[model samples]
Target: MTASLVLAGFGFGSVAAQEDATTPRATLRIVHGISGGPEVDVLLNGEVLAEAVPFGTVSEFMPVAPGDYVIQVVPTGQPAEAAIVQADLTVEGARSYIVVALGTPDAPEGRVYEVNLDEMTTGMARGRFINAAPDAGGLDLVVAGGEPLFGDVGYGDASDYIDLPPGTSSLDLRGDDDQVVSPIADVTIEESLAYEMVAVGQVADGSLTMLTLSTAVDPSCSAALGLGGAIEDACVRLTHVAPDSADVDVHVNDVVVAEGLTFATVTEFVMLPSGEAQIFSVTAAGSPIEEALITTDLGLDPGQAYEVLVTGDTEDLQLAITGIDLRPVPAGQARLGVIHASPDAGPVNIRLSDGTAVVEGLDFRGVSEYKAIDEGTYELQLSPAGDDQSVLLTSELQVTASIVYDIVVVGRPESQTLAIVVLTAPVPVQAEAIASPVASPGATPVDASGG
Candidate 1:
């Protein structure tokens, strides 16, 4: 064998031994000054040679082939754009190297501003602190670039001030219960601006709550009622019924119809035309319900349909008056058709209240076909719930004993608004039947002479 003493390179054959021996390895240490750590990765010839190491931690890898290699140090979970440091280093076989990872530059913390309200007058200027995030709590209020305005109070209840600034300004509200800060609310300060700070919790409450009572009638005949006629005047009664007393106000078309009605509960009234439709709104002090107007003037005609709606503050409470058709029936009785539309698709209770007793046993769902009701001076009301529930409609209807009449109740799509239409026949009829029922039933029938 000519004494061919094969010199195994590290127990490998000579050909492969030279290649394995020439391979070079590197070790890197990534460091960061911030609380979050940095990640480290080693590459050979632009190819990743090992798994990434945890940030702010040290990791070791096997020797890599000696050549120009790149070392990358990046923040964990961040892309290459977020790489804190990067370097290209040359490694020789059997040699060791160390790399130090650097951290990103620090960002400045935000400062707070102080609002003083010591000189503000109560009731003269109403003030309250609202967070940008409706659900967030505690926010810190302090003097910009200065110590906290309120000592020891930090950014909690004592930090915010209201009704002090002579003008309105954006304010940051910190929650006392948690580390939540409200987005800025444009607070108008008309009284004093440079006084002691007021806690958000101490602000006066001025929110409004609304209750609605609605009913529908034939638009053609009822349209005249909305114009304020004695024959078509209607009223909606909203009772607070809540244990706590409230200041109630009623509005129609943004006009204040009633205000400052203080009671444990309240009753509101709205007038609608006999063949017209409209929206009514009720507001109660210190409630979250917004003041809104219901729609009247539903474009209804004979043989057409419409709806009337009543909505509550709670999302779960909604009432719809649907399937209202206007037609001319005989005098003594009027044809009234209505459907209670609800998401639950359940039955709705109907009641005819004469302002004293309630007539029960009336329930409907979806589309209730047209039915004839005896005409008289009556208040027609509907409630989704059987007893003492919110009213969907409350209005007076006068039916002539001999003329034909049609009433249609229509519900608005995706809204708690309703439209009522009343249709009347042109046919001449007995004057006694058309006369107001309020006149004594046994009294002599008066002639048409301006009686």
Candidate 2:
């Protein structure tokens, strides 16, 4: 009975009241899609339900005693006391459960995906997309070269399941503007199975990405439904690390990549033609540039990233180039990545609402996974990584749809230096929601997470 976070509607009801109408039987299939995480074990009321369940694993539906069982998802080989996610599930005898283990080790949670097969046409595959990317905006899941499947699937929003012909298809995730953000190729759907396409991970960092889980139809079907970081180019990131620097302009081969760079300013990952030598220039901010303050050469490599930073005093300005193996974002939606560029601030953690840690262990030159939140108002709270009470800054941002941004933390602490430099560009907007041919469950409370 360790402390656990309660999920939406993970509430209580008398087991006897639920069993009054039918026999005591419950069946469930577990879908695992946690990225940059370890294999997990599932336990029901302290009993092992499944073991060594790896990432992207879909378990066969297994029958369980229908009652008030506390469901827990623990890392494989770990004791039950270390469960990462747990829930109280009381299911009726005639019904089944599709328990999805989503989020990352950083934000793991158990979600139940429920489907009514009778509402779907016979002998067809039922599918939908659930936006569990935490920070991603509206998303669309479409079959490659085919019509759109789900559109404008917002945060915590689940599209009504649509029935598709069973076969192999290339699945791509696009932003609301319809540009392919995630190129998940070659997914095969079998006959009479229900599939849940989960969009996970950050667009900037390639972990916790998109994956589909197909569960069979029927109470006992196959146990019911079961469930790469390869960088091609060397992404380049720029930052201003000088603690007391003024707003400055940065250039690469005469191209103004960043402008008005105050202290601790950072740029989003810029795709560079890797394996070449490039020169970087720093000068005072504004168009009619004065003499460059500092110029340096960067010999970057393919399949890697280099951070070109400007640091030191006004009298002795300097350049520091550091090589890193980092991931980049794809096209489609606007990506908002972060960086720890404040040299005065040793290391810090960033959180959304001071609850979920978006970035941690972030020192100067550290980059955070691009968080893909919707185009709306969001308040980001900054605190020293582990301490809860010592809040550093509270920033409220206004983000628009389809625009990618690089939110840089700039300024020094002594002057209470804190401000944001947002670098923005528009991405493709997806088409509006295409009506699903399959009938939706009427008036029922839709659990967007499928549970």
Candidate 3:
């Protein structure tokens, strides 16, 4: 018998399919949608449902006893007692569903969606669309040179189910006035299978893209995102901050990276290939090749993001490079970076109000890389070169999952007015690829980064 199982009380999830009363079992598939999260194992009532389900992996449908089941997702190989996302899942006999492990890893939110598969015949394929872009406005999607497949789709909205001829299809997304926003070509859809196509991330940052999910195996789907949305290399943005510096042109190994850039201008990140050292050069806006002003070398690692900010005065230039980790944090975890930016402060150590040292002997304008920790209100203290008892500055911060923060020393240690400046910025959307360049007042924002 055909039917749709609505999870009205259990998080309002919906499951649609046919029921086989004689079998007395429910069919289930799962999709791993938590970006940056580690592989996870799904369990029901202390029983393993699936193991080591990695990011971007999908699972097929399997039969299970129908009733109210205690559902949980934990790191692969961990004990069942340790769960990351837990919920109560109800499955009716012979029904089917797609349970998706989504949201940032630190604050996971799993979703249950029921799909109907009665039209799996004559080489036909079933599909639906979802909009997951964080800030994209209404969008129009169409087949290559064909009628609209999805029109005016808003953020977080899913479209009606559709039937299409199985195989690879070329598609493109458009904004207002039908202007092409992104191209999603060469997507393959197999016959006799159900699928969900999603457009997720921020469009302006070049991370807005697509993914095609299939519900056959226990939790199966395609790649993370396309339309060139996912950045697989080191990312960097340059900013020019010297107060007395002229409108300068920047270069990386003789190639003009950004030209005619004025002070206080922070350019959007320029995608860079990782695993190599880069030579950055600066010259007067209209200067000749041989008369460059300054140069610096920076090493960028793969699967990470970095920032190179030009600091100090126009005559004595400096480059401050810091790495930004966009990897998913475990559930309930947060990340922080401490920077020593007090121009006149001597080498100082960072610590907590309770006398725990976090950074040691950091010199003027130095920085501590980002580190993960449990979310909480941290009372920070700056001491004289690791001497926690000699607290110089203090600040309290409340951190949350998937959020990054920069705790900066803003005044001279010897100055009675010394204090800590806590700057907070949003995590890079799904791409999570960005860096922050900290600049004090009387300075500008010209770093190969932002904020």
Candidate 4:
């Protein structure tokens, strides 16, 4: 039988697909921790397991039968003969493993470590450290103002799992001489879970950083089971982009969460329990839920991030939900996506100034996948899908390294309030600073409509 697979957000949760309890199977995942590396694909016995996985991104857990198999890693799109790393992996039944592709871009290596999923003491967290940093030799994983959690970890070595108290604390990677190699700030160690602290990148080039991976079923989902629910929280953000709509109050499940939210504003991520239908209502500021202008029932999945856009004019407003991928970009690159949210704008096309199409025939409420691109400034043209001659907007898009950007096409066509609003995902604090001309504000959205 084929392995059961489940898509995950930031790699959380257990085997979602149902299987026989007596079947002997193992779950496996791949972590792309190679610093400054090109996107790579993981193949198991000639079948593509994970495709085009960029640096610092984790693959979804896949269950496979217990056996010895040929595991290979190659630059994405390359043939099997071009494999950079290849080995035989023996997976045992009823266990989980994380195969990390580490080292530099030119010279890569792979290491497999079994995750600690065994039951542990209450009120404690289990963690381990892996030294993937090629140049940083003999490192120590320590909690700030505390003793070392894992010490003298050599390159490519994995430490045994250790239990720690649940709390928030800063983490540090120190060198053999007791010098700090990298400091990870405000890491939360939740009770009854396990984590992998991987030290990646090169010390000489100042690309040293840490990647934290969780290997547990989300606790929120467990808590939901106790509350007669079956799923974890879904991360939702609200963006008020309907230019002509009056200031409004937003309600979820009959509770007013945002009041007097005006145009061009957005709410932080709201954690709402999933596995049930949720009522979302919008009304005039200070108005009762009975007077809601629009009410809809939304069912969301656990462990996913979604952006809900309030679009169109007040008379014919609508809600549009777009899923956001929070995976990290590879070193020296950026992830960009486009959302067609304008009410009056029909199907549109986005192209570079040189007439290269970036997105084509994207209709209202359509969302594009986040595409990776090199860091630079470029002129972009937006126009009606079929009629390319009549350009609707022209603007410069500035993007920096290691950032994710989502550009929303907003504003009504008649009132000429058409524009593009940019939303950015936070950069990884443990990342090395990429030397680029782009300033701190990595991406800026220009007024495409000349408003």
- Going through the candidates in order, what is the number of backbone clashes in each? 75, 20, 22, 0
Worst 10 residues of 2 by lDDT: 219-228
lDDT of each: 0.33, 0.60, 0.60, 0.70
Q: Which candidate achieves the best TM-score against the true structure?
A: 4
TM values, all candidates = 0.23, 0.43, 0.40, 0.49
Model 3 lDDT at residue 314: 55
lDDT of candidate 1 vs native?
0.33
- Write one digit per residue (lDDT tens) for candidate 2, span 250-333: 776667777798666566555544445566678988844348888776775544445677865577677766544111111122
Q: Which TM-score value belongs to model 1? A: 0.23
Lowest lDDT 10-residue stretch of candidate 4:
429-438
The model with the greater TM-score, 1 or 4, is 4
RMSD of 2: 20.5
RMSD of 4: 15.1
Maximum-lDDT candidate: 4
lDDT for position 190 in model 3: 66
- Range of the 10 consecutive residues with the lowest summed lDDT in candidate 3: 218-227
What's the true lDDT of residue 37 in model 4? 86
* Candidates sorted on lDDT, descending: 4, 2, 3, 1
Q: Report the C-alpha lDDT of model 4 over 1-451, residue by residue, as the tens digit.
A: 1111212112233343223222335567788878888898988999998899998777866656556678888889987777877876666654667788887766677777776666555446688888889889999988887899999999888888888777888989899899997888988876545688888888887778888776552233222112222224565678888878889888888876678998988775555655457778989889999999889988776644568888877788888887665433334456678999888889999877877667889988889876655577877788999999998988798877556678888887677777888876533211211111112221221111111
